[model samples]
Target: MKQLLLVFTILFSPSFSAQKTETFKIKKYQIAILGDSLKESSGLNFFNGKLYTFNDSGNSAELFQISLDSAKIQKKLNTKLRNEDWESLTNDGENFYIGDFGNNLGSRKDLKIYKIPFRDSLVLDSTKTISFYYPEQKDFTPKNLNNDFDGEAMIFLNGKIHIFTKEWKSKETTHYIINPENFENQAAEKIETFKTDFVVTDASYFEDKLYLIGYTKLAKVYLIVFKKSENDTFFRETPKKYYLGSAFSLSQIEGIAVNKDGIYISGEEFHSPLGIKKGQFFFIPFSDFD
Candidate 1:
C-alpha cells in the first residue's frame, strides 16, 4: 500500500510540493476503554462545559455526552436527522456543526453538513443544512478509496466552515472553504494542500492552534499541531508532528478534540490480525508533549 511509503511519499509527492517530515513518539498518555454504546465514536467535541461524541454511519441520529473524567456516556441528545456518515464534530462558540460528509468510496455527490442549534447546553432538533460540492470533482466515478474528494474533518472558522480532505491515494489533505452566509448549494473552494502522509479523520481548533489527527493505511497513527500563521492561515507553516503509536495497538484511532486542559482522542471498534479489538479513548495533557 502507498501508506507503507509515507517517508518517501512526503518528500516526492507529485501532486503537491514535497517537504520533509520527522515524527516523534508521544510517550505519556491515559487510555480508557469506552462502552459498546460509543463503540463507533467517530467524532469528539466539547459543548458548553460537557464533552460530546456520536457514532458514525448506519447508527442512530443521537449525540452522546461523554464524561471527561471517565470517558463514559452521560447523556443522549436525540434528533430526527439521518446519520449518513457523521465524521467530525465542532462548534463555533454558539452552534455545533456535524460534518456528515464521509466519502470513503469518493463517489458521493450528496455531501452536506448539519448545523444544529445548541442552546442551554442542549442540541435542538431544528437544524440547518449546509450543502456543498467540490468544484474539481467533475467525475462521479466510484473509485473506492482512490478519490481525492473524500473528507472527514472540518471546523467553523472566520465565519466560514473549513473542511480538510482525507486523500486516500496521495496521503495529503486539502483545505476547502464553505461560506455559511451563502445558504443555497455552494461550491467548496479548495484553498491549499499539505502532504501529511496520512488520511486525516478528524480535526479540532482551539486557542489559535489547529490539531489534526489521522492514521495511515498501514495503521500508523499521527497527531499534527499546526500553529496559526501570521496571515490568519491554518496550514501555511510546518506543524509539530508526533507518532502516537499504531492503530493496531490502539484500535482504529479516529476522533480528536482539544481545549485548555489537554487533548482527547477517540477510536472506533476495530478488529485486527492481532485478535485484539475495542474502541479507545486517550487523554494527553499539554505538558507531556512539551
Candidate 2:
C-alpha cells in the first residue's frame, strides 16, 4: 500500500502544482503618457462613456477625465473634500464612491468612503461619508508597513461594497463586504481570503468578472481575474493570474478598469535602483486574454 501511495503522490503532485503556478505573459497593446497632472493616479474607472482616475495620498483631492484618443487630461474636477489617502474608486450608475481607507500601518481608525452624486453633476461640493472598521481586526496599535489591514482595491456590487486588503506581511488579500447605505460607524464583514503574494492596488467588476491589478515589492506587474461562482461569490474558486511583465516595462501599475472594448490600466511613476518610469496608461485588448 505504501509503494502504491508513493507512486500516486509523485504522479499527481506536479500536475496539481502546475495548475496553481500557471501564469501567462501579457504585453501592453497601447501605451500613452498621462502627463504630470496625474502623476499619482491610483484609481481607474469608466463612467458616462469617459475614462476617469484620481490621485492617491498626498496629492490633489480632484478626479481627472482622460481622453483615450488624445491620451491626455480632458478635465480635472475638484471634489472639495479631503484627499486623506484616497486609493480606489467605484460607481454604481447613479453615484460614485471614493475609498479613503489606505491603512498602510494597520493603525488607522479613520477609514472612510465618500459617496458623491456624480451622475447628476461633474463637480461635487459635498458628499455622504461612510465610516467603517474591519470586524476581524482587534489591534488598534500601529503595525507600520507590516500590517495587513492596508487596502487599496474596492468595487461596488449588488448594493454592497466589496473591499480587498493588501496584506503586507502575508501577501494575502482578505475580502470584506460593507453596506453602502450605512453612514454611521459600522463593522465590515469578513468573507474570504486569497493568497495573491502581491499588493493589490485596484479592482474592477464588469460582466460577472472581477479584475484586479497589483505589483510585487520588486515591481513585477500582475493581473488577477476571477469568475463569479453560480451563487455569485469569488470565494468559491481560485482566481487565475497573468504576469503582465515587469513594472519597468509597464510602469508601477496601480489602477485597472475593464469595459467591452478592453482593459484600461494606469500606473504611477516609480523611482528605484532598477530605473525610473513615468506615470502612464496602458490598454490590453480582450483578444489577449479572451
Candidate 3:
C-alpha cells in the first residue's frame, strides 16, 4: 500500500478558500465504524437493490455486500481481476463497472475500467476491460497530488461512463466520458467542467439528483447535489452544496450512494502525524438535509 502517499495526502494537502454552503453536523448520521477489511473502502454503489463497496489499490479485487441495517459486510464476491487502483464503482443495471484509474501522481498511462456482468447476485464468467486515457494530459510527469488527472468518481448512464476528476490543484472537477463498448484504448472525451471548490471522490446519480462527495486539503468534507439535469450534463443547473464538518470529525468521506430512502456514505480510515481516524458508514435521510 502507498503508506507514504497516504501520509502525504493527509499532512501535506494544500488548503483552499471557503465558499458559502449550508453547514450540517455529520456525527449524528454516522452509524458504524468500518472495520479493518474496509479501512480503505474507496467507493460505494447499489447494484440490484444491494449496496456494495471495496477498498482501493493494493487490496483484493473483491466487492463486499454491505448490510444497510448493520453497516456490516454480508458477503464478499471475488471478481478475479487486478485491482491496480480501484477508485470508482457504479452499475448499468445488469453490469457493475469499477474504475481502476486512480492517477494521483498523474503519471499513469494505462487507465482502465472493469466491466463484469452481474446477475442473480453473481458475476458472470465473461469479464471485459474498458481502457481509456486523457487526451489532454500530454505530460507524463509525476505531480503527486497536484495534477488534475486523478479520478475517483464515475456514473454509468446513457450507454456511457461519465468520470468526475478529483482536481487537487484547481479545487474543481472536470466531466469526461468513456464508452464501455469500446474494447480498444479510447480517449476519454472531456464533456463539461465545474468549479466545485472541493475534490469529488465519488458520485451517485439518483432519480434526477446527482450527488458528489469529497473533501478538501484541510480536511473539510462536502456534499454537492445537482438536480434535474435536462441534457445529460449535470453541471447545467445550480447545485446545492452542503458542508458536512471536517474529516477529523467525520472520517475521510470518500464514497456516496443515493437512493429513495436516503443517502449512503462511507469514509476510509485516515491516519497521519496529527491523529488517526477510523473509517465510518453514514446514512442521512433526504428530509434531514434537503
Q: Give the best candidate by lDDT.
A: 3
Model 1: ten consecutive residues of lowest lDDT:
1-10
Per-residue CA lDDT of candidate 1, range 34-117, in tens?
A: 788988888898877778899989888888998987788888888678999888888887888888898888888889988888
Task: Give the whole-model CA lDDT for all candidates, comma-separated.
Answer: 0.80, 0.79, 0.87
Model 2 ranges off by over 4 Å: 1-27, 123-126
Query: Which order, best to worst by lDDT?
Result: 3, 1, 2
> Which regions of candidate 1 are displaced past 4 Å?
1-28, 121-125
Summing lDDT over every window of 10 consecutive residues in candidate 3, give the lowest-scoring window: 1-10
**What's model 3's lDDT at 95?**
90
Clashing pairs in 1: none
lDDT of 3 by residue, 83-117 (tens): 99999999999899999999889899989999999
lDDT tens readout by residue for model 2, 1-290: 00011223323432111124345544446478767888778889988778888988888888888887645888888888898889999988888899999887788899999998885355465579999998778887888657889989999988999999888677778889889899999999888888787778899988999998886665567788999876447857777888777666666788899998888888888665545667778887787765
Best TM-score among the predictions, by candidate number = 3
Native-to-model Cα distance after best TM-score fit, residue 244 in candidate 1, in Å = 0.7
Give the clashing residue pairs of candidate 3, or none: none
Candidates' TM-scores? 0.89, 0.89, 0.94
